[model samples]
Target: MTILKNRLFWPAAILVALLIVNAFTSNQFVTVRDGHLFGSLIDILRGSAPLVLVALGMTLVIATGGIDLSVGSVMAISGAVACLLISDLGNQNSVGSVLLIIVIAIAVSLLAGLWNGALVALVGIQPIIATLILMVAGRGIAQLITDGQIINVQSGPYATIATGFFLALPVAFLIAVAAVVLITLLTRRTALGLLLESVGGSPTASRLAGIRSRRITTMVYVVSGGFAGLAGLIYSANIKSADSISAGNLIELDAILAVVIGGTALIGGRFSIAGTVLGAVLIQALGVTVVAVGVPPEATLLFKAVVVVALCLSQSAAFREKVFGRFTSTRTEAIA
Candidate 1:
């Protein structure tokens, strides 16, 4: 009963329910095609990779009571940089060149993140306004990098990042897993998690305790930007092209939603990487479920809203007490 009432339990149940629904809708929803994992389930994992990576970074930022609105723009910039370079290369298929280009793209995103952190931590600007400046300008910058045109590349190794299979799993999914593991170790294995929580709970209090809140806040934005850069790479590789206008459009919002749905409060404090991963997967699965169940294209957001509302209600302790507690009381009385 205790486990059932847990906040994460509901979302897990909902995810399983969605999976069951998918299984019923299609005979091969969970199949491994041609000895490789290429099913609807795998598709959800691949599709969720970008969102999961972004949400992981968002989780850290939210833990510090800050938001990075510029993540989408960072992603746009990263993808634009990578694809533009690949397009310019004489040997687009060279793995080494692609690797170097990936590093350069991510480096640019880190710089963008540093820019955001400096504004928020040093200039005392609000997180929203500080990131919003870049959010608005980032795409324009990406457009400039791409010369107002979409850049397509024919790099086989670059494409492998998104489409290749690794140990019977999508490489994109594996990348997201690697990110999740890195974050988990960084927070759980170190004192950084507590420091972040302390800062989020009260920046002034953390500063008084000599926590260096400013540096912490700035560091999170940098990490967020770097993760967004990775997401950008996966996204552009999935399509084998980069369009400045569409690369990471509104991804920040989705990442935020995933973080919240994963049980991280917007007001900051404690963070949950596992929850964020689950939330990202759930959201992506919802989209796949909609298509599997034949929901109309225009009604997609509506369906997602209904599901999100359920999750919100489930997360409310008071709501759970008022609703499920009564049932438990009734069952106990009947047994007595």
Candidate 2:
């Protein structure tokens, strides 16, 4: 009974509720045909890949009591860099060019991250203020790379990163899964996860305990930026164009919202990559539902915002305590 009433139970229940609603409202919501799933089900996972990747990164940053407002812009920069390289090379089939471009893109993103980390970690700048500089400047760099115009590159290998699939699931989804797994191993399998949470939960205590909190904080942002860069490449590959103006616009909001909805406290400490993935899928599903039902496309954004608000409210401290407090068992209470 105590386990059933744990704080995470309600969020899990709400996730199931959304899934049930989706199934009932759309005839094709859960259909599996010819070894492929279609309708809202496919749309959710497909749309969520970038968000999942970004959210995984966000979880780490938030865990260290920092935020990377520049992720979306970094994504744009990464995409622009990748597309320009492919366009300059004149073909995606040029394996040498492809490899070189990816390396350059990753390097650029890491450099941006290093700058952010230096500002926050060494110069003692506030996370918001430091990243805000790049958030504004990064997009300008992306536009400059594209010569202030969208660049289109039609390449099978490039498009395959986004639009292609393996074993009927999206390649993007697979990549997101792999990223989550790797990060989980890095944090959970090592001492890093606990140390990060310790730092976030109480920085002074962690520092007194001999944790190198500053270094960990810096690393979080760099990893976050790298993930954002990867998302940019996937997104650009999907669309086959690098649109500086619109690619990844407001995606930071989506990622932060997903992180919050995943039951990860925005104030920092605990992180859950699996929960973030679920939250990403749920938001994406809501968008698909709005579209498949013939509602105005613009309304989808508004609905997504509403979902975020509701999820946040339900996952708030007061709600969790009130709804889940009563089922505590004597044995568990004693253990606590």
Best by TM-score: 1
What is the per-residue lDDT of model 1 for residues 152-252, given as tens digits with 9 covering 90 to 100?
A: 88899999999999888999999999999998998999999999999999999999999999999999999999999999999999899998899889989
Q: Number of the top candidate by lDDT?
A: 1
Put down candidate 2 lDDT per residue, 6-66, tens digits, no spaces.
Answer: 4455556666676667777777775666776666667677778898888888899898888
Candidate 2 lDDT (Cα, whole model)? 0.82
Q: Distance from true position, residue 170, model 1, in Å?
A: 0.7
Models, CA RMSD each: 1.7, 4.7
> Which clashing pairs does model 2 show?
none
TM-score of each: 0.96, 0.88
lDDT of 2 at 250: 87
Query: What is the Å distance of residue 126 in model 2 from its true position?
Result: 0.2
